[model samples]
Target chain A: MPKSVTLKDVAAKVGVTSAAASMALSGHERISEKTRAAVKQAAEDLGYVPSSAGRALRSQRADAVALVVPNSSAHVFGHLYFMHVLTGMSTAANAHDAQVIVSTNADTSNGGVAYERVMRSRTADGAIVTSAAIDDHHVEGLVASGLPVVLIGNYPHLADAVSVGIDDVAATEQLVEHLVTEHGRRRLLHVSGTLDHQTGIDRRDGFLRAAEMHGLTDVAVIEGDLAEESGAAAVEQVLRERTGDERFPFDGIVFANDDMAVGGLAVLRRAGVSVPGDVAVVGFDDFGFARVTTPGITTIRVPAEEMGRIATERLFDLVDQRPGGRAHTELGVEVVLRGSCGCDPERAAAPGPTHSH
Target chain B: MPKSVTLKDVAAKVGVTSAAASMALSGHERISEKTRAAVKQAAEDLGYVPSSAGRALRSQRADAVALVVPNSSAHVFGHLYFMHVLTGMSTAANAHDAQVIVSTNADTSNGGVAYERVMRSRTADGAIVTSAAIDDHHVEGLVASGLPVVLIGNYPHLADAVSVGIDDVAATEQLVEHLVTEHGRRRLLHVSGTLDHQTGIDRRDGFLRAAEMHGLTDVAVIEGDLAEESGAAAVEQVLRERTGDERFPFDGIVFANDDMAVGGLAVLRRAGVSVPGDVAVVGFDDFGFARVTTPGITTIRVPAEEMGRIATERLFDLVDQRPGGRAHTELGVEVVLRGSCGCDPERAAAPGPTHSH
Candidate 1:
């Protein structure tokens, strides 16, 4: 198909100039009817497909997929969650016979030159965007440009955007229910991450709603950044409140994320507080460390890797022009029950002589 | 400089064919003496650098650095250590205004078409290879092709290779000393990764050497495939031997990597073995999880990120034609004392109710 037919081939068969034959075959009005008919017949006889279209389908493709993390490289690289996400993408991409190129979006600070060039580079078939950052403009811009994009976050405003994510609110609600029902905790404290991010808002709201529904009389919420230090500090604040007021009762604490949970556990340990026996603790984000931290942290597994795989598959569907390519996918999160929520005392980790690495 | 002086400028001034002017300026004898002299004088007067040479440094460049992980993509994306390495590369690449392209050498299975194309693709100026796989031919091929290359592991066979890595043997020796002198652990067992890889070989040799030097009578080495399951099975074997003979006494165990160590810890826990009380365990590779594990896994930090950064810097040196690009660099490792080594009995982890995630 590539070398068998050319303009010259048709022109030679038609006994006309290559330029004239090209124009005639393309139905240019300037060419004589006889000449145009002859050129068209010659083209059909030679089984010619347009070079531009053929190249667009084959030679022009970069055969690479872009994984866009719309956050700082530090954020993406530091968290194993994102690494797991990348792992899934790599696996799916490998199956599709394509290499995935990571776009950390640090270059967005440089007028988004890198992503803009990615749009232009025909080698990159499409992009899977992890819109972890607040700014949606970068993602919106890509969608606006009609580039095939599958986002790994919930963006309600971008109604047409294809997305894959878990229902953070529901997941948090289930976690709170576990505390109230399974652990039989009446007094509860929900320590939330920064409310600026969507995840923080969803989980916080979920916690409050769950507390109200359960008809728990002793419950409170505290605002803190998602840093582990914040978790430790929040725990101290709780202890101080309980000591001073004598009415501030709390038996179970829920950390916004596992990092914070780890910190809170450290503080609880130093203070000689018996976990589950005195104050039950639970965390979110089932990171690898969450499971191994003494009494394993019963947290919400965000399906981060699965999100990556599904998003990539959806993006490829769009790239491949398949049906339902732009469908919104809502993945479910699992409540990984562990010792933190006082599930099973028998599985509690044996004491070791060290607290942290 | 880009727009001010071009080949056209020299061509217009010299009043000769571009081919003739280009050849003359390059000292090609095909051009007549008068033409050559005129072209040379015009080039000098115009401060013109040959387009070919100038573009070789700028326009023809991909302006991206390739990170070649000569291992399966699963091996890389599955491990946070590799992610941290990528983070370091990303940070350094960002500083240099170059984006990093991760090449998970799985394509090498398909005849290395991807990396071979990377060599031909002018946009990728240089490559930093993590020679984790046993095949040195892939690395040697890149070196032989004259592409600027820096390795992140010791490659003694590639004499001219620039590399950055921690001394595994020395690190292991120090780790062994900690268990022997600091913790007073006499009978020991070393769980080594598969010997097919260099890391496994180095670490095993290090463990044997350290044992011989320390003069510990009860020392044994067990080989595994570097999987957590292998470590678990190894622990079970230790328990079985002890149960049957009543003489296979072991006070401490060293795992080749943290994943195995975590596994072994779990096995010990289920067997009702007391960590640091009955058996002190240690691991290599200070993965983030190493610190947070129940009794906290004592580990040797591999300096994965630092190695990435140094290797990248050295790669840029070769690409930029700077001095001393191909020098061997040995980075140091750190021994993190934790509960597993019984370093701080006062800091034993508070027991929890759950086990592995």
Candidate 2:
């Protein structure tokens, strides 16, 4: 095989040291603009693209980010949440001329050992941790190890870690407020996600705070694992108990996420409960089908994709040793009103020809 | 930095040449078992992990696979199909002691140039192309360049290419036959995905052939973009046309995928059409929400994850120059019966509590 041109050739052509050529080619601030231009032109002229070894040796970068996602059996691969995040992360990486290396774990206990090896072997420069569970010790270890890490979700305990997350607490509070104020909803039920993760806890906290603010004594909370099965099961128990004004009359239900909300809506529909007319329902993380579903689900449109994009960009800034300005960013969310909520049925889409029955 | 230990240090300690040490470390067949063990022990003893540069220079392999998914607006991130496939692909790579580098493209016109650099720079060893579009000329260019390539979906014209895909034709055919034999439905409407993709063409062909076999002349077809919105619009238009025995007694609707099917179900329910009663409905690619949806969507369960896993493994086999037994793998799909189909409403979950209105 013919010998390929290398950094040495470019250096020689530009009459500079190999280190100078590398720095200039990499656009180092220390290198003069004149030298940078000269090195780049010479590299192009000589067709001196860095081989894997040359690139690895010269830049000392993998140009890759490891995205560690939660591997829940039901939600991880089935729900649109992670998919949207991954897509956004991938898009951001692509735009930045980097690629994403994805790894899935229910809890990231083994993250450190695995990610340490990843960094040591030059498989990736840094990692973006998507799961910000309450008991995520491995994340603390990753931060302690001084490896550039960016958390995709909020971790209350690890306040110092770099992160980009949604305003889960405020968003949920807003949804609850929407139900209480405009809809005149007093007795309520919050179908919450598990308390294991920061999102669930924060959202539930938001619900309780909102409930207290409304001074509603007749309120209840049911824990769901953020899956449709959990939501259906929870609602089934409610039906079996013969829910009505005789007991804790829940005028409205607030779901921690859209998945559970959709399930709740279906269960309520089957039971002959009229949505909005009887029990108002509102959801979080306005999933893709939210806009199109029957009764037109009222929801909070979480910036899942934006979170992924920002987290990725933050990871790159950390990996490249640049000051990324903010260490934490809490993106804003929007409240979308529809037929599911009693506030405004006008915002819902026309049921059209299929509304006959 | 305390001069981190290198391959040279390991070799010196093991009393072997650097080449021998590298071969032993990499588990090359040329290296004896004793040499491999000794090199490994000495490297461990000295804590001599190859730095990023050294690993690249010695192994000459990135040990990563690039997964290029379709960057469609609606389905790519929102649907379960892509997420499940990605999760499985990532898992397969992890099992093989490799990592997955993800990319997205609607059309792969720019793939060759990007992937050409990816390989040349040792960013990834091979790529798995998920799109099997009829006009996928970049795939042809990739094949011509002798790069290790694996297509996740089937393309009939590319007979020489390696691929792993579902038996789309048989799966769709079986679905249509079920609608006829079990439901005893003569008039039908097949909602098809876009014809630009091989999947769409084959599925549409399957529906047509099944109709021909049944000798049903009252069947009609509606074109969709494999999106919920597409399915909703098509069904809406049908409803507006006053669909009945007058125009064409369409008793069942076969959706190309679950997203569209879910959309169709909502439109029908709104219009007072009872599923599997007034008109049966069946969907393809049993998505996550299929089981929980009211009336339970009857659909085909495509091995999306398996396809991704198999395609990844095949790409690695080709990259490692191993003779993978089969050049193509068409995984079998199963027909799932539920309340939406005429066969076995018992199979549907007791959508208890929420069937009232």
Candidate 3:
């Protein structure tokens, strides 16, 4: 391979001091435009490469931030859905002339503590934390350390920390209301994540609020772990327990996320249960595959990428020590109407006997 | 937040020189076991966080490697499947006491030129290149630079760089053979990726080879960009051109990846085609959602995470100037039979179909 061209080469070619060339390349106002142009031309000619680390060392900022998630490394690549949020953050960061460092806890053993190591050691100027839990000690620690940190999800007590997230409760309420009033569905099953998580808690509260508003007090709730298997297992349990009900146990189902909803859809399809005809379903987090599924999935669309970008930008603002900045941000969510809910006008208007709430 | 404990604090607590304390914490052979234990105890008591970057600088190594993909940051995180591979690399790297830097040239105006910038600047000690094409200039340049580089997929005419990839051709051949011989599939339709990409070329080649071996020459091939939209578009084109044939144009369809296959499945289902009964379909890269979908997709399971780990280790080995190492590695792939391609009797007879291939 050819030897890399150094700043020295550019300086020599331009017949200027290395300091002058550096200043010119950095676009220092003190440098003359003619000398800056000369040095730049020389740099281009010689293919002089600038070192981000070196520049960071001199400037005391790397112009890069780390996006830290807590999980085993293997899980990072295998989970394709995260790619969307990551893409959004990267695009926004790049637009700001910054780079991203993706890191996770060393192992599952340490959990939140591993993040402490990254922050204490100043691995990156700031960090964006995703999939954050309500009692995330790592985030609390980072906030206490005066580090610039942004979270993709909200934690109730971390009022001092910058965060960007969807209003899960409001979004869930919207979906439930649509299913109950608009679709005229009475019996409903809510497949949800562990209630301890903020997302799960908020979504469940929203569903309950909607049920109360619509006077549908007898809603069945099944706990799931936000995984496909969990959804399938929950469905199986529901099916077994609802043996001799005169009215179908549930005419509508709402899943905490798209993955679980999809799983539930699969189980229902395999059992020869009619979707939207016998039952209607809605999911949260409008994932890419939601639309591709048969009958599609009516769901709440969380602006995943936008949330990531905003979170990162908020962290950068903190890193830059912006004054009088607030810590919490809540992004918007939308209800997407699709085939799975059987709400298509044609399907709803069909002449066949229709079940009403 | 409380101030982070530093090396000085550890040394003060241990009643030893900072160098001695550092050596003890590093587990250097020069330090006595008793001294190491005492130093470690002191560090633990004080909550001293060792600096990975500083330690790497002292050791004349970065203790970090870069996983470089020639895509934008948004693209990197948009796909959920990549999370697993990234997770695998991170987990393995952490096991070896290393960190990973995920770099992309997605925004670079000049194609493949970012590799030159990264290498010339020595931003990473070594790098793992994923989804490499046959004529990838980045691989060629890295090889020429004598850098510790590993390719996750095959690259043409580059003999000196280490590679870790599945045999795309063989895996595709096995998938096709299973469809033709066991499932009685005929008139195959192949949905392939862009022909320029190595994986796309090899998979297409394997499909054709299998067809030749089975004495089934009546085959149709459609090109796609290995995305859900591409898959949907390809299926749409095929359906439009079929001219109402009584026999379905193809009894079996093979897709480049799960994303495309899922898209194609959606289109077919919407058109009232019974999966596996009227048409059988197979996808590559058995992603997480493949099983959760109705009629769970049949696919070729590539060891994405394992390959990532192997590539990272090999890159590190090369960076460390290890002796007597080969320049390439071929990882294995397996065929996963699921409901989409018709149930596997053997699998059905066994415990469950949930096993990873």
Candidate 4:
């Protein structure tokens, strides 16, 4: 291997003292922007690769962050939407000159196996945990470990924990309102994710709240473990139990996420049920698949990438010991109109064609 | 924090010596399967948390692996198919009681910034690098770093490096044969991913070889950076450069991946072109979105998760210093027929609905 470049080399090239160079490289406000740029350029030109050991020793930081998702099911990890979050986190970490490491199934249910290893090894400076559940022992363990951590998605029980995400309850309420007022749908069936997840509980609560507010007496709920197969199975169960005038009891079905919605749509199609005409359907997380679906799925657009960025930014703040900024950062969500909700399906179905770079 | 359960505790619970417990936990052949199971059960029951520091000191291994992808564009990271690969790797790692850490942009083009940190910090026992380009300095640096690394996707130039993946050439040939023999597509336009990538080169070669075998003279190729936007833009360019009697020019178009294929399909729709009626379209990587597209894209189904599992298994083999197992492990691919490629539009368009937990 070539001789590793040093900070002194960068300082000499920039015609500045090592202290000045260090300040500039570190983005310390004491150094002028021009000096900082020059130092960074010089460092780049010199191929100044900082030794991880020396940097860790000097700053007592790993210069890396972990993005942990407590998913035991390999299928959940395959959710394309989380890829957007990963991209956002990676972008933010790259901007800060830090690395991002992703770990899945690092939950307390598994004895916090991955988390314990990461913390004990000091593999990362801080971590951003996503989709935290209510009364999650993993998050509690992370909190108790004295590691800088930030949670994405709301958890009222984790009120003291730093989090950055949207209000799932409000988003679902808005969706339900749209379904009720605009579409004139009274009998609704909610296909929910696992209650263990805070998202499922919050969305279900919002659905009930909206139903009560609209004075809708006929309402039903079905359990889906946030999987497409479960959604299809739920449809099968609903179909098997139908009687009288209403073959399908519900006029509208709201799914917890787009993945399950796709499955439900498929089941409906196989049964020769026209979307919106027979059963108006809506889903959360407007994934790429939503646009391509027949009639397009009306869904809630969560700012997944933005949430990831903000959560990472919060974790970095805690890692840097920045005070007063560790509170929950709640962003807003939008209800995307599409054909599945009896909207102008053509134009609304137009996918903005997501691009990543 | 509660005191971490030690080997002694597990040993006592299993009615064995601490040394025996350690040997069983470490998978020593001296221990019987029953003893190993008992020891593991005891450890789990006691919630034994292994100290990474102690494990590292004893085994000179991190008990973790890094799955790194060279993603310059933020969009590339969002390629939904990667989730399968990640799921596979994570599942395999979980089975081995090891951890999987995902990292991106660990390229030498960025002065090997991420790679240097990962290496210097010794964050993982080994790494599995995916979709490596032909002249990737980052991968070269990784190989030279003397780190036990496995490359996914082929790199003919890196003759000395260990790799595990499928035969991209054969897969592409199968796609082309299906297109020509079954669909009767003569004029073919291949929208290849960046030629700098081994996949692109190999696939392009297959297309040419298959066309030659069919005695076809009209064949063209276009460069795409594997992003959906690029595929859409390429469609626009082709339309702009079309001649008389052929507004679109090509009878069939094959995209490198599903993302680009989705983009191409959108452009085709905007142009009022009938898929398979005006021009047949096929894509690589049969992502879930492929089924939902209006015409349902015919695609090459690469066993992504299996590839991930095999590659990771290879990396672990090297990490364990096992000999005669560093061979290139190639899996098979299948062509999934759907509507876009001039097949049964109705039945093929039916999405069987993907499931995620």
Candidate 5:
């Protein structure tokens, strides 16, 4: 056991040629970036632990990672928030002895093509992507094919690739300031889904900047595909705009998740409508059927499997070329309080509250 | 593409030495099973299609597959039946340009030690496993480490591996003959989850063989771990064995899933009972919170992402060694109806009924 370090001991401490120290310790582009930093500093001065079977025989790296998602986002597989971010990216890629390989998109407009043939057959070492869309040429062909891609949400025009998200504009401006200061409410509506998804354009710009810091002006948005029959057809198109007469009555709705707030509380219980006494319902991703639905649902939680375990541990610190953290990570959001936002009906009819989020 | 037959043209038509035709076309144990079937019959008589970079430069095949599961199956990531069998095994491993990886178990008592270190670092070319238990030395250490494992559920004492499942004892005797001949319900209970799982011993031997083929000898059983707080603590231990007087009268129960029938319908809606009027519930995996739980449970659906898309298309037909199918496949199961097994209270208070499941 004391004699293990090979690639001929980092090519005899970098005097080179063990196929140039296995193509400069497998970063490979036919070596020379100053001999791949002198065969990675002679494999960290000969500790040489590179055996994922010698990096899958010099750079075919099947330690696996992939994730990908986007089969044209068909409600991301009936969302348990992408199955708790694929079980926190398979329990942080099984605590780093990695393997996650999800892949889906049979061509979300050419974005996955089996995730660009598993990163051109190197067969995966990095890739997280999740439903990315802003200027996404499949995340610009995985950052123009250089590889180790990350992007779970924000693109910020790919400035140095990696990403991870949460601040859906300050958790939809603290759930629209708890529906306008602890339920005083105002004519807000939202609904949303396909604003070409940057989390539906930062939660419809945090529900119009919390209805313009409370000077509320009858907000009303709509468009949905984040299905629960598109939030019960946006509450039957606002009950045919209040029985064909522009009564404009939405005293608060929000949605954009929790399976469209359990289809807007079963279309406001088949239209008798009296949640928070008439409308107030919020939702984001406090999902497990938002505490078994019947009157419980005021949400925002969103640590969706801790943003899939910190975006696969920041794409394995950008696939082991680790450096500093925060390559734009975000995560942090929670609001909770249930009983359709009217307040805690006995801890919202109990069941899942062992300190949520 | 016509000139793609490489490995030095099948080692110059098998006269050998292209590194012994890349270790006898990668079945590698340092060659010689009669030179690995004559370099796979001279690369299949020169048609030669091997290139996942020539099978990852001779079989370090990160062409990926793994799935695994068992991190002590804590309701397998809030089960949408394992996210529709991981989206039917990632759409049949993205139609065979393969890559699926999931993995999970960071030790469910060694039943997938990170899926046997991603198949001993060959970085996965086989393995499916998901929830298998009976005699499972983590699926007999993946069929005695010969690799290409398949399991999904069933052990049948390993007899030459490959498993795939469904038919949990004839889908629990067609859900206990629809609760004893279409809701006659002669005293049954079940609940189950931890019968050391071969799907809780084939749904408790299909509920005691449909209570001894309906001769109805008051059945009971209990155990649970398939959480919703273990079916709300097995309905408070059968309501403390019927208010402490051993007055045993359980109309019908069943459970085994749908997160313990949504915690046994919130403990029969906080004990007022009346589901199918005083008790009748059935559940197996027809989850999407089994149609927004109020009275909508009547269950047993399980195609669980079409048995994870036919056990990952028969583990990609045993990772392309391809023979015909059946190494114990199983599939087919559906029962569905609603209103807590009584029958359609207006199609279970109508919400998701476009024929669910």
Candidate 6:
């Protein structure tokens, strides 16, 4: 096997100091273009790979970021919700010329171990955290360590931390209002994720606020794990228990996330319950499958990918020590009216041709 | 801001040689336990964060692997199937205490540029490649460069290259056989990815072989991009052009991948056609949302996560020059029988519980 080349080889080949070669290859502005080209060419010819650490030693930048999903490894892989979040984070991180280091634990209690390792080892210059709960200890730990951190979801207690997220309350309120006033959806059921999560809490709170404002008192709430099975089981429980006609039980169902919504949709369809014509439904996070399902879901487009991009850019700015930066950033959400919500009457009459994107 | 601590600082504080401190901290067998404890305590006191690249240099290991999806960056983010593959790969990579650097281009043609950059710079010690076509130039380049490379899918031309993938032919045959024997379906339609890809070619060949074996002559084929919309539109074209009494009209559809299958399912449902009863369907890749849809798709489950794990480990072995290793590895596939194929007659009879994995 051929021996690996080193920076000294590139420098000797280019007739320059090793430090000069390193600086030139790293795109330092102090180096002339001719010298940079010569060094790069020599390095390429010799297959002299510059180590990220060597570059960091000179530039004081790791050029890599960490994306922390505060969930167990099992949960991360099993849940579709995390997949969407990961897609957004990875795409954005790659766009910024940075790689993402995912941190997860084997056990739920060891969630902080991954972060501690990243921190004490300085494995990443900055971190983008998703699904941050209020008063999150991990967020606090990251802040205390002085690492640049950005949150993808809201954490009310971390008022001084940079965060990027959608307005969960307003988004859910708009969804509920549309179903109640526009679609005449009485007897509403709000299928929520674990209330421990800020997103679930805020969304459920918004739904209740909208319900109270509209004088719709017959609201039933069910808690789920923000997974498809949870949504299906929650709805099943509601169906098996509901008793009187006067209760006007659940003419509409709203899920906190798309995975749950898809699950709920399947359960409703399986129960021979007509969607929209009977119980209209809406879901959060306009995930890819939302359009592919039958009677396509009415969902709030959370701009998850966009939020990820902006959050990463902000974290980069922090890592670079930019001044006058604010602590939080919020992206907008739009309600995508689809067949399930009954807001699109024409959809029921003449459904659009199903196509893949 | 606090200045980052270095190994030299730890050594100085601990009154040890830099080499002794390094060996001690790294847990080298040559170092005494007492010395190792002293070195470790100094490191913690001084906050000496070990650089991954520096460690890689001393150990002659990159401690990182690359999962090269040869498609463009735009294509990766725009498609959900890639997201699933990435999730699986990420989970596996993380479990092995390694980081995965995902690299893609803006166009498939530009795949070589990104790969060449990584290779010439040695950003990763080894790479697991997916999205390589049968005659992909990128694979050829990597082979010539003598890097540790693993192909996620089979490439018959590169018989020496290590690969971890399912038997596309056998999996496709099983899907066709299930539809024929179980559902009593006669007319079979195969929706495939680009013919240039081995997966598409193998799956198409398998479907044809099954049809021939079953004495069915009416086999129709549609070429799609393996996207949801493409699958839907492809089927829509077939449905629109078919004559009312055309002999052996397609009643069963086999898609090359799950995204396309989901799209085909939506298109069929939108056309007022009942799935399984009117047209049984099967998709490949058995991704997360496949089970959540009504009449959940019957598909082949590719062991994507396991494939990724084996691919990474094999690449590590190759880079590290482990002996007695072969060039290619092929994994297995399982047929996930679900509602879409009409295998579960009970599912069609009533709304069943949502499926979870």
TM-score for each prediction?
0.79, 0.83, 0.88, 0.80, 0.37, 0.90
lDDT of 1 at B197: 67
Per-residue alpha-carbon lDDT of model 6 for B1-357, expressed as tens digits?
Answer: 356777888999988898899889879999889889999988877767676666755666656677676652245443544555556666666666666666554323332366655654566677878878777786877876777787888888888777777789988999999888988887899999889888889999999999999998778899987777889888888977989865225889999888888887766766766677677888988766567566778889887767777777777778778862667777778899887887766655564221111
Sort by lDDT, best first: 4, 2, 6, 1, 3, 5
Q: B48, model 1: CA deviation in Å? A: 28
Q: For candidate 4, write residues A137-249 as lDDT tens digits.
A: 76777777667888888877767888888888888888889999999999998899989888898889989899999998889889788888888887778887888556578
Of the pair 3 and 5, which is ahead by DockQ?
3
2 versus 5: better TM-score goes to: 2
In model 6, the clashing pairs are A270-B351, A355-B229, A356-B228, A356-B229, A357-B229, B73-B105, B162-B327
Clashing pairs for model 5 are A112-A115, B274-B278
Chain A TM-score for model 1, please?
A: 0.77
Name the 10 consecutive residues with the lowest summed lDDT in model 6 chain A.
A348-357
Please report how far candidate 3 places residue A175 from its true position, in Å: 0.8
Model 6 captures what fraction of native contacts? 0.23
**A122-150: candidate 3 lDDT, tens digit per residue:** 55677888776666566677777776778
lDDT tens per residue, model 1, A1-357? 012355687789989998898789668999999999988888777755333222333344445577776653334355787777877787678678665776665665534545544544443678887745445576777777777788786776677888898898888899889988988998988899877566778889898899999998888889877777899999889878666535336788888899888888877776667676677888888867787777778899888888888888887888777886446899888889887788866675444323222
lDDT of 2 by residue, B239-300 (tens): 88873544325788999988888888877766667676678889988766566555667899
Runs in model 4 deviating more than 4 A are A1-61, A71-75, A95-98, A106-112, A144-146, A241-251, A345-357, B1-61, B71-74, B95-98, B106-111, B237-249, B324-327, B342-346, B349-357
| DockQ of model 6 vs. true complex | 0.33
Task: Report how closely model 3 matches the true complex, as a DockQ value.
Answer: 0.28
Q: Model 1: runs farther than 4 Å from truth?
A: A1-60, A71-73, A113-125, A244-248, A320-323, A349-357, B1-58, B71-76, B113-117, B120-123, B244-248, B349-357
DockQ of each: 0.16, 0.30, 0.28, 0.22, 0.10, 0.33
Best-fitting candidate, measured by TM-score?
6
For residue B139, give model 4's deviation from the true position in Å.
Answer: 2.6
Instruction: Put down candidate 5 lDDT per residue, A249-316, tens digits, no spaces.
Output: 88788988878778877766655566766677888877688777656678888777888888888887
